[model samples]
Target: MTQLITERSTDVIAAEINAIKFQTQSMMLQASSEIGKRLIEAKEQLQHGEWGKWLKDNVEYSQSTANNLMQIHTEYNSNPQAFGNLSYSKAIALLGIDAEERENFVQENNVEEMSTRELQKVIKEKQKLEKEIAKKEADALKEKKLLQQDIQDLKQQLEDAHQQSTDHEDSEKEINRLTQELAVAESKAKKLEESLKAKPIEAATVEVIPESVQKELDQLRSKKNESTDPAEIKFKMRFESLVNEFDLTLHALDGIGNSETKAKYTNAVHKLMDKMRATLEGGMS
Candidate 1:
């Protein structure tokens, strides 16, 4: 029974110690919030240089320690509803987060129940995850922009290709039209050539006598018709036939190849015709 009582007492002592530790932690957090509030009030009332000197002289706390305590309280004191269960150290660890984040962080990680070191570790992991997510989002946005640019480039290329195709089609049509026009022109030229080939060549024909030569022939015919003597009539008829033969021979001279030969032949024929004309005139007289 004595042993049982000793065990029971030991259990009660442990519970009391735990309770005291809890109360102490709570008091420390409250003190931290109160200290932050007092510091703010003191700074408002005091000058900067005077406050620094007074803090160093009157308070045993160093500037840095005071600032840390003040920050911890500033972050959690006003919003004690969320951090009421956190110890001063644990609340200090959560000061890295904003007021809005603090409530969520406490709920998410059960920060009130966590040790200060544990809370810090969890925050570190959370920051790393957020950083990775931000990097992925930035990379995705960059890729999306690049994809849009590529699509625009492809669309421009397609437009250029389409324009080129249209231009080529127009060129082909022009070429075809020109080819058809050329064919038509060639056909017309060929038909003209064929028509020229089918027709007979114009023969070398007799040229018309000069007007002066025609008047002389008319006078000669009138004189012949007035002649009554048989010999005169015979001479006149022979003279007229000779003149017609001379004209026919002159027209035939057009076929001569050598100009010198043609001139010599023409001169000889003129001399012979002159003698015959003189003989006919002597007979008529």
Candidate 2:
């Protein structure tokens, strides 16, 4: 008798648990439909500010709770063919996703088999992944904008440098022509001095050349020797060294990943070259 009573008690306990499960499932079904219907009907009443009191007094539910129920019906009730047998919790977790995504998610994950906790976990993971991707896209767009600005600045700098280069070239050309003329004049003066020495002064009254011409020739020779200036030679050497350094730096920049930084350095190099050219021209002058 004692053994039979124990078996009966165990069966009763199991039956009680099953009954609770059936009642809970029934409550969820009604909440999905009935709660959704009541919320929809109360939309106008809500605008009139009556539904808040109604929800508190008559429905005995918070607005957030009702909102979840409405989302369930909106997402799943009308599309039960796609989202079959979803629990209230799983459907709530899927509220933010659209219909097509709901269908795919349900099919892909066998959402019906998932417990509420498992579904919520997957939803959180999905949201996190989406946020990460959005952040990456935003960062890439920002980086692209910075690069474009750098390129624009570089273009403007190049244009300015080109104009400066033209001016420097003109100055260099004119100075080079004058230096060549001074060299030729010096050579001619040396030949004249030698010729004057070779020709004997037959009479003291006979002038070898005009005093003014001789004085001018001597001044030209002195200026020609001074033109081999040490400062000018040093400037040329420094300019050549800087040019080679700039080339090497540009080559190194090609290996670097940061184009914006490289562009800034390149602009600096161009400015330095311009300054060097100006200094050299001033020295020559």
For this target, which candidate reaches the highest lDDT against the unseen true structure?
1
lDDT of 2 by residue, 56-163 (tens): 997788889887777776666775655545656677788756667878888888887778898888888887766665664454355345435534543554455455
lDDT of 1 by residue, 1-285 (tens): 455543467889999997888778777888888887787777788876787777888776777777878897777767766666677778777777777787887898777667788889988877776666566445435534543553454355445545555556654443443333333333333433342344321123212234575476456434422333445544444544544454445545655789999899979878986998899799999
Off by over 4 Å in 2: 1-27, 167-285
TM-score, every prediction: 0.50, 0.49
lDDT of each: 0.61, 0.59
**Weakest ten-residue segment in model 1 by summed lDDT:** 199-208
- What is the Å distance of residue 207 in model 2 from its true position? 92
Off by over 4 Å in 1: 1-8, 45-54, 166-285
What CA root-mean-square deviation does each model show from the true structure? 51.2, 27.5
Task: Enumerate residue pairs that collide in model 2.
Answer: none
